[model samples]
Target: MANLDAPATAIIGCGNINRGDDGAGPAVIARLAAEDLPSDVELLDAGTDGMAVMYRARGAQQLIVIDAREPEGKPGAIYEVPGDVLAAEPVHGVGLHAFRWDNALFVGRKIFGDDFPSDVQVYLIEAQTLDYATELSGPVVAAVEKVAAKIAARLVIAPEA
Candidate 1:
């Protein structure tokens, strides 16, 4: 059960805002910014920096991340992913951007030890056009609002997790 008196929940949005549908995270951030959130809830629009994600997730007890996932489905198909699922996937990359939420968790665990949040949820929005575009695709635009609302309902307005 969550300690009502010391609830530390953080909602982080991760993606490149300039890349078409890849901008889903920032879009969700935009929506959540318009709402009145609880004082205990922190919202971070962490662009493609995995280190930033790890740093921000350190102190929170519950963390929710929103991002545009690798191509896996039709655009706007939202997937609610657990941290373990990402950890199970093989990580192949040269630099920081290659490490995503799972990597963030791994780093956090190594550095912060018990201080890192164990409850982590990643909301993935499939992309259609992740090209050099600033605006989100038609489907991803709709999906952003849906995701933003659903996350808000689950974490912010709802009684508990």
Candidate 2:
């Protein structure tokens, strides 16, 4: 069960760490874990589990998600997109394992209504590769630091509503 006194903000990272740059999300979470964030902020290493992302985000005033995207010629490129712009309904016949963070945004809003955070942000880091590996590529490693710093900076002054 979710705590009644949930954190004011939830930051979720989604990706598969074994697949090279796909690990960018969790990598950022790792970086943030060492920081001194406010108690009203929560950091989650969702690691490709959309259900976890959806349930964890409930009752928070804000949600921030980080993930890696397929190669687009520019590895390490960062794109900040509004959650509403990326949210999409899950396909009807797909298994839960196939569910994604975008689907979580759509379903979470429908199920949780106002309890779900309205201030949602998604950060996508362009990938250099998704091959089997345990480490992020050189460029992605740099982007992880930048994104982590950016999120940490935001949390410093973020309202505890």
Q: What TM-score does each of the candidates earn?
A: 0.85, 0.93
lDDT of 1: 0.81
Give the Cα error of residue 58 in candidate 2, in Å.
0.3
Clashing residue pairs, backbone N/CA/C < 3 A, model 2? none
Q: What C-alpha lDDT values do all the predictions have?
A: 0.81, 0.92
- lDDT by residue for model 1 over 62-107, one digit each (tens)? 8888999766668899999887566553356336648776678677
lDDT of 2 by residue, 1-161 (tens): 34587789999999999999999999999999999999999999999899998899999999999999999899999999999998776558447868888999998888898889999999999999999999899999999999999999998874569
True-structure RMSD, every candidate: 4.2, 2.5
The best candidate in terms of lDDT = 2
* Model 2 segments more than 4 A misplaced: 1-3, 91-94, 158-161
Q: For each candidate, how many residue pairs have backbone atoms clashing (under 3 Å)?
A: 0, 0
